[model samples]
Target: MAGSLRYRLQPIRKTKMYRYDQYDHLIVKERVAQYRDQVRRRLADELTEEEFLPLRLQNGLYMQRHAYMLRIAVPYGMLSSPQVRMFAHIARKYDRGYGHLTTRQNIQFNWINLEQSPDILAELATVEMHAIQTSGNCIRNTTSDELAGVAADEIIDPRPYAEMIREWSTFHPEFAFLPRKFKIAISGAEQDRAATAVHDIGLHVVKNAEGEVGFRVLVGGGMGRTPIIGSVIREFLPWQHALTYLEAILRVYNQHGRRDNKYKARIKILVKALSAEEFARQVEAEWLDIKDGPATLTAEELQRIAQYFTPPPYETLPATDAGFEGQKTDNKGFANWLKRNVKAHKVSGYAAVILSVKKTGVPPGDITAAQLDFVADLADQYSFGEVRVTHEQNLVLADVKISELFTVWQAVKAQGLATPNIGLLTDIICCPGGDFCSLANAKSIPIAQAIAEKFDNLDFQHDIGDIELNISGCINACGHHHVGNIGILGVDKDGSEWYQVSIGGAQGNNTSIGKIIGPSFSAQQMPVVIERLLNVYVQQRTEEELFIDTVQRLGIAPFKEFVYASPIPTGYTHGEDACVY
Candidate 1:
């Protein structure tokens, strides 16, 4: 993998990708050139880490525990096969053989030479991608549902609005140096699959009594040292005024969000301090003056941008395809994979397939260069050359034809991508914790792997139903542990590592933070703890209820007793009063 980094250094190849327009290319190109100069200046001792830190961060470069990590944003979590191949190229040339896909719909290359980062950015620019605004105190990538346009339950297509936000927030003059980083997520479906309630700003596409589309805006929701649910500021804002309203919100946040303390600088804190109603009043006042200004969206402009996201040329067919059904019945493996990985699509005779990267014993979201190329090939062969990255750290072939489902499943299975665990407990969302991150209090990957191995049986997982098991190395909540149906956080007491458990936390229509069960336990006890929780759910659940439903119906009290009944005598009970941040 070391020598392979010199993969011909080919010029970036263009593909049929959405939102990679001339304007995008130009902006990325110029930013790359600027960063290259900045790197040169730093190497020449014209700047120090303090001076060069922000410059590197805005470009998505981070000084990790071992080396620099570059986060490449996949705007709206959409990508093309050609762009994926470029990722493989970067993996071979500049870093290791694999990259980590993040919960925020981006990829992180963990091993990179600071000197060659500019060259890597230049290569990315050729393919109409960059690391701009992927980090820093500005609006990060605007993520939407992985199944946005193709979802069977979508009310509106969110890609266009997400892309618009990406453009507006990229290096915006007034917001570039905000008090804290901001994340925005939009969901156009009835179910909140995008975890919008946990973002800095969450927008849900809704319809007014007039039958016109608008946005239901929520502000201040965040997870970190302080996890708080966002508050609704606007019940209904016209679609055209979405951008202007967002600008008003940001302006108020930028002006008043505390900068003296980093922990309290997020817009969520500001909104909490001012009260949602007061914040709304201030933003409304600010919005009235510039509601119809240049940033206001126009109808023609929306349609123009939307054209890029229109569904592919789907073939008209019957509601049920005989061949697809026959293939499913004939092959048990395909049947299981279809039952888990394949989801109904808006288009008849088509399905959206999730490529599970969370296979047991493997790091939840790690994929190698060779596997990347293979998945890229699969995307080209069956999904119109497009792929979507899920917030769960998996990939999706969102528009696979039902007739070709068997073929796609076989190909992916051969490459170890068909784990048949989507939405299951083992389909864990994990982070590169203490193993790679400097901020992690404990190692996350190993704990996740341990739990995954314990519950690796497909039959057992299917019986458990949907469970969102998320783990984070620290309270930073990068793994979004707070929102997982079963959340685990790694905490370091003195020098030993232990994990704390939470229950009933969930995302979607009924978003709520999980309640911590009890004292932290050793990493080895994670599987036993999770098993006890599942056992309690199995015993108490009525009919065929889901995990979250069972937990909600019978409060966390039941499971808390099951887990902490005979506490392990490790003396890690200091967590009794520990804040579940």
Candidate 2:
């Protein structure tokens, strides 16, 4: 690895292997051979860049600012220990010694040679994973809650349905060349960890009056230049009709979705233009033809898919592990971890632990190669040889025994993975920004770094309470700025970097878009503006009121008054006064 900051920012490209069955192995092996030939032909000028672009993108290859970047699918954020180890292995062997986890729960290798991509695809195919449908204007990786099966409030496991959609949409002939990319998210829990409300098509598992399992489907919800929470189209859609209904929605979008304007190509725009009711009627009309068609999920196939995600044979344990108390009494750091990272598991003695990536001053959601290996080892040691990547870009050790949590925490902490700020203000969600992305308007990473540095005091952060601060380099909203309780968007004002702020947005069960507080602030003024906003919240908030709640009750007026009061210069200095932004 190079020591230069530019080199450190460079992406890695590695060969990945998948865990495949006989049929899948054969198909992927053949596809690799085919792709290898395609690569050769393209290199030989048999195919033009324009013609080869889509072909390569469909295989997860992108010609980025620096090099060809490959995005590998981690379907529904699920990964076995073996899969995780393979990812670590690829990271170590490739261009760099690390990989980046995306907002979509996929892993991206930022540097690769075009000639080596087929070899990489071949390696991934061996592990039952691939970059297929990771790019291009088609249904991408179907995401779900990381806590799908184990959450106490879950109605059903969503992975089987996610897998079903993955299979149906992979290389679907009609949707391959749609106007724009499509994303679908499913959630089984009452909590919206999957961000279902912000997807192109969102499905929430539900049971109707008859106690029959089905889907409460919503359409046209997405975050970007136009952010809208999905509107419910069907109160109850039978479970078996998942594929058929989704196909109908996609077909309509593929035909009528905007192709003339790239900015408005998303299906969310179409849904907005027609209204949710009109979109529903259009889908209903289309579904009439495919209701009983081949795309309808079959019971036997669903059963087979469900088997892969069946709960591990967990041993019964006592409600409270006696060993845990002694461990907590001995270690303060471990105790703090238990307080912040652990979540309630459905099983009594088992715990789901969130391995926070939001360590102060580091880029949020970043894990090094060594850290990845350590997590793999911890998963194998404590969990059921499995790990899950969260929508928030953290790792989850889902089946750790309460008795072993102390040991797990110690190991995680040693590897710099035990940041005790899961949903705190410092746990910012940010995109690659101007540092790596070609589409960025300004650098988001530096802004996040500045914010984290200014708020490094844990007590101050806790006092400010839970705030979802999201930053996006551009209007695409990959960092989910629209739904952040405090959103920051990077915009190019002339040639300088300016950030627009929004407040009161949320993405849980009660989803709402953030409202702009006032005018944009220059990068140098951002940290001060944020401080003023927090000061306003702290002063106006009643007992136990969160930043969001305070804003909701009193509105953004008080915060606005302080933020716009002084009209600071572009490179303004606020003395040594931390409170006066």
Candidate 3:
């Protein structure tokens, strides 16, 4: 809430993980200097708004509904304690006293001052962080699994590959200005935690029959006005050619992708227009020309990148900690927290913990400056001084020792970060909707608040079991409503706000889009409508069946009929002609 930026910039802290080379450091410093001058020129009435628009966007500055929003990238969702503390400082100094974590693994401050934007970038540069390629019609942050290195189901770690892509895509002259913003997500885990099926390119790390690691390539997957899942163009692409192959895909897309219509500029539209088979053919043809060019990933280069992501020096100990087990047995609250928030790590003596930011009454993914500092302390004390930001809008202490689980849980709970709702309906993934973002049709935070309040009973939420309920302010699908088991999308009818409901959508290996259930509803009717849909699911579900499976088995007819059983309002209708009550 401070209006003046007074904090002195600190010396850059040295980080062992993801160390930026001299070139990386130089790029960030030069960018900060350049942006500072740009701000000066704009303020002096030398640069017009039109002249400054693209320049400002290229640095991750956006003019939101109320103020400038600065998006800071967390490459592959990885963050160190010092870096997080910097975020807290920035939140308290330059903007409001909080930051919102986005679905793309970035943190956004919604109340930034235009003049202080350069200062913010300079502060971030002190920590080897920047906002480059975070906006504009360029390659955005390349996301990967939050549990990239330590997941038990992982065949190979994806962070090194993600880093490779980040290095390749950032400031690439040829592809700097694409048809539209491009996004890529890679997953090394078997469960697909990164939501790869919804990205422009989804790379799954796997092995071939000869026991050589490679990638399974998927192209043209996206969610927005047109929500289409990606199609697999190659079942297996050798690891050595990953970058070259990506270049080929981009080259093909660049050559033929539509540039006139911004609405239809995403690679998904092109893939659909050309057909997946034809698209694959074009990519392959382009790839032949640069199959083994300088961009080809070699074993030595991979090892160089992999060194930064090597596991921390972990203590050798028994898998089960007796103290932790006894504490779980004695405390029901701790037990519930463990059941929901704690996850299995590949190492026997360690576990991964998700510190929930979706507590009742708080906007999902919004963390205060004080809370950020608390998480930093937890990271330093128990989790190797590092944390990860999840695509689902939560933070993870990925390397917590098993013996410290109870202590970590208690610390987090005291700070209101231990909501014990990881995958339940209350653990909603939502965007900063009409409240902050200029593009939203309706307010999304209030809807999430209403639903979380309605399901205030932990016992009731636990009974409902694992389910995904996502709310997006608009069809941009930044909230990923299309893939939730129950999705809520805000829409505009005339001059009022309404919501459309969908069922049967899911993410992961078997990803599918949800179908619209019926007519839109008023804001006040949302909780009850959701209650009706859950009522149908509860009544029709077989023993211990998850929500998605039940929907897939019984179909949406039962749920749709149950929701629409009541008489339609006097002037209300479905689809484009519908009237908001």
RMSD of each: 6.2, 6.8, 5.9
Error of 2 at 106 (Å): 0.8
Q: What digit string (tens of lDDT, one per residue) describes model 3 on residues 197-314?
A: 9999999998999989999999999999999999999999999998899999999888888999999999999999999999999999999999977788788778777777878888
lDDT of each: 0.87, 0.82, 0.89
Which stretches of model 2 miss by more than 4 angstroms? 1-19, 567-577
State the TM-score for model 2: 0.93
Q: What is the lDDT of residue 462 in candidate 2?
A: 60
Cα TM-score of candidate 3: 0.95
Our tally of clashes for model 1 stands at: 3
lDDT of 2 at 40: 96
Whichever of 1 and 2 has more lDDT, that candidate is: 1
Candidates ranked by lDDT: 3, 1, 2
Residue 61 lDDT, candidate 1, scale 0-100: 96
lDDT, residue 252, model 1: 98
Clashing pairs in 1: 5-92, 5-93, 220-268
Please state the error at residue 61 of candidate 1 in Å: 0.5
Tens digits of per-residue lDDT for model 2 on 1-581?
Answer: 00010001122222111134455566567768888888999999999999899889888888867878889999899887777877887777764777777789888887787877887888777667788788888889989898878898889888878877776676677888889999999999878888889999999999989998899998989999999999999989999898889989998999899999989999989998999899999999999999998777767767666766768778899867668888888876677677778999998898899998888777877677888888888887899788888877788888888888888887888888887777888888988787777888988988898888878877666667678899999999989999999999999999888899999999888888999988788888887877888878877889898888988898888888877887655564544335631
